[model samples]
Target: MLRFAPSPTGDMHIGNLRAAIFNYIIAKQKGEKFLIRIEDTDFSRNIEGKDTEILSILNLFGLLWDELVYQSHNFERHRNFADYLIKHDKAFYCYCTKEFLEKKKQEALDLRIPFRYDDAWAEIQKKDNPKPVVRLRGSFEPISFYDEIKGRLEFYPNELDSFVILREDGIPTYNFACACDDMIYDISFIVRGEDHVSNTPKQILIQKSLDYQKQLGYAHLPIILGESGKKMSKRDSASSVSWLLGQGFLPQAIINYLIGMGNHTPVEIFTLKDALEWFDIANIAKSPVKFDLKRLRYVNREHLKRLNESEFSLLLQTQDITIGALGKLYLEEASTLNEIREKLGLIFSPKDIDVTYEGESFKEECLKLFEVLWGMSMQGESFIEYESFKNEAMKRSALKGKKFFKPLRILLTGESHGVDLNELYPYLRFYFKDILRIKGEK
Candidate 1:
C-alpha cells in the first residue's frame, strides 16, 4: 500500500501536494491500495479544519484514496505497543526531571558537543516509579536502508540516542506513531520529501525494537525551489493551492505543470488522464525543480486554448459566443480567466479622456472618434461592420495612420495601447451599443 501522511498544522505546502501527486499516481500504476493518513497526533498545533481543507484540495485535483485513517484514532494501539516494548526490555521509563535534562543539555552546550541521554537505565530490571516519559533503548550499531531515489543510505550509531516514544501525557511522538501506523496499515512503500530522510533510521529502529521486520521502500524526492532559487515558503503567494485557484488557473494545468516539471513527458501539454498513461519514476529529475510562474502562465494559456466553443463559453460562465470569442481574442493579451475577464471589463467601462496622448491634436481626434461612435450607437445601429464604422467616423475627422488608428484604439478599448483594433472589433462590434453609451453625447 501507499500512503500520503499530512499534518494539519497550516495551509498545505506545494511540496506536500507534490508528494501526494507522486504517491497517488504510483499507487494507481502499481494496482496498490492508496491511503491518506491525517497525522494530527500533535493536537497542540493542528488547526481546526485544516484536514478537511487538505482533503478538499486533493479532491479538486482528482486524487481519490482507497482508505482514510486518522492517526489519533489509533491511540489505544499505540499505548499498547509502548507497553509491549517495556515488557520486552526494549524501552524504559525515565524519572529524569525537566531541570535535570536541561542541565545535561547545558553541559553539552558548554563543552561544544552534542547532547545524548544516558541509556544505562534502559537495561535496569528494577522499575522506577513516577517516571515522566517512555524512551527507546536505541541500538549502538550502524543503521542503513535502500532508498528508491537516493540509493543506499547509511547513518552512524551516534546519530541517534534514546528518544521519547510515549510522552508524559501518554501520546505517541511523531516518529513513534508514524512507524506504528505504517506497520498497522500494511504500508510497504513510502514516498515523501527529502526533508524526512533524517527520520528514516529512527523510525526503523522503533520497528526493529518491536521485532517487526518488513522491507520498506522509500523515495525521498528533491523539494521544489522558488524562481529565486530558494526553498518554497508559505509567504510566497504562489505556494498556496487556494491562491492559484483564486487566480483562475485551471486545475488540469496545475497538475500538468507539476508533473511535467523536471521530468520527461510525451507531449508539451497534457491532461491528468494523459499523465496516467506515461508517468515513469525514472524520468523525474533528481535535482530540485524551480517553480517558474511565467512557465505556469504559458501552460495555462495552452490548456485554455484547447477548449471547444461550448466549453469555452461554459468556462466563462456565459452562453454567449461573443464573450467566448472575446476570450479567444484576449488570450493573446492574457492567460488566466480572471485576466481575460479584466480585459473584457476595460472595453465596457467609461473611458477617461482627460489623459493626453501625443499632443492636443491626437486627443482631439480621439474625442472626435468617441463622439461619432456614440452618435452611431445612439441612432440605434445595434451592430455595424468594422469597415462601415471606420469609414463613417473617418469622413467626419479626416485623420490617418497613427493620428487616426491610435486614437481609434483608445476610443474602442479604453487603453492607449492594446490588442489590434481589427482583431478586437468583431466580437466587440456586437457590444458597441453597450461600449459607446455616453449619456450627454454632443
Candidate 2:
C-alpha cells in the first residue's frame, strides 16, 4: 500500500505534487491500495480548504487515492502510542524551558564542547516536578535503513537527537504521528522529498519501538531547485498548483513535466496514462533536479501538440476564451487550441499597429504587403510556393532588409521567430479576418 501524506500548511507546490504523483504511480502500477493522509500536525500553520484544494488538483491530474485520512482526527491514536512508549521506558519526560536550553547551548558553545541537547536530556531525566514533554530514548549505536533509491544510508547515535515525540501542548509531533499512521494504515512504502532523510532514522526507531510488522521501503526524491541552484520559493515562480493552472498550464503537462524531473525513465514524454504504466520508485534519481522553465515550456508545447481539435476546443471553453475573433482570421490554419493560444499575441488590435507604424516613411509599403497577404488564400498555394511569394514580395517592394521582415514577423505572429511565414500565413490570415469582422460589427 502507498499513502500520500501532505501537510495542509499552504498551497500544493510542485514539490508536494511530485511526491504525490510518484506515490500514485507506484500504487497504480503495483495494483496496491493508495490513500491520502493529511498531516496537519502544525495546527497554527494549517490553511483552511488547503486539503480540499489539494484533492481537487490531484483529481485534475488523475492522481486519486483509495482512502482519505486526517491526522487531526487520529489524536487519540497518537496519544495512545506516546503513552505506550513512556510506559515501556522507550521515552522520558523533559521539562526544560527554551531559556534554560538556550543558556546551556551557549555555555557549551563558549566552552568549545559539543553543543547539543545532552545537558537538556540529563536535566529532564533528573529534574523533579518536570512539566513533562516526551522524548525518544535513542540507541547509542548507529541506526541504518536502506533507502530504495539512495541505498545503504546509516546515521550515528551522536547525529540523532532525543527528539520530542509529544509536544508540551499534548499534541504528538510529526515523527510520532507519522510512524503510528503508517503502521496502522499498513503503508508498505514511504515516498517523500529528500529533505526528510535525517528524519527517516528517527521514524524507523519509533516504528521499531512500536513493533511494526511490515518493513517499509523508503524513496526520497530529489529537490527541485531554482535557476540559481537554490530551493525554489514562492517568489521564484508560481508556488501553488492552482497558480500554475491559473497561469494556463495544463494539469497533465505539469504532471508529465514533474515525473521527468528526478526520475530516470527512458520515456521522455509521459501522459497521466504513461505514468501509471511506467512508474517505478527504484527508477527515481538520487540527484536533485533543477526546474527549467524552457524544459517545462517544451513539455507544455508537446501536450498542446497532442491535443486533438475537439480536446483543444474544450480547453478554450474551460478557460472561458471566446474564439469567435480568432476563428475568423485563421479559419483553417488554427487547427488546434494551442495554435489559437500561440497566435493570441499575434492577433493584434488594428489600433496597436495603427499607432506604431501608421505614418512612418515605410508604413505604406508595409501595409501594402500586409494587405496583399491578408486576403491571400492557400487553397491552390502550396507552402513551398508561398515561400516563393515571400521572396517575390521582398524583390518587388525593395523591402528585403531586416527592419522590413522584423516588423512584418511581429505583425504576423507577435513573435520575432516561429514556423516559417509560408506555413504561418494561414493562421495570420485567420487572425486578421477575425479582427476585421469584429471591427466591422462596430
What clash count goes with each model?
0, 3
Q: What's the TM for model 1?
A: 0.91
| Worst 10-residue lDDT window, candidate 2 | 433-442
User: What are the candidates' C-alpha RMSDs?
Assistant: 2.9, 5.6
Local accuracy of candidate 1 as per-residue lDDT tens digits, 1-442: 9999999998887788888988998888888988999999999999999999999999998999999999999999999999999999888887676766788899999999999888764334234436568998877898999887778999887888888999888999999999999999988888899999999999999999989989788888888998789999988889988899889898889988988888889999998788878887667777999999999999999999988767778888999977888787778879998998887777877665667665544557777787777777778765456787677778767778777887787767777777877778877877776776332453
- Top model by TM-score, which number? 1
RMSD score of candidate 1 (Å): 2.9
Question: In model 1, where do residues sit more than 4 Å from their true spots?
Answer: 121-131, 357-363, 382-384, 437-442
Worst 10 residues of 1 by lDDT: 121-130
After TM-score superposition, the amount by which residue 405's alpha carbon in candidate 2 deviates from its true location, in angstroms, is 9.5
TM-score for all models, in order of appearance: 0.91, 0.80
How much is the lDDT of residue 25 in candidate 1?
87
lDDT of 2 at 204: 88
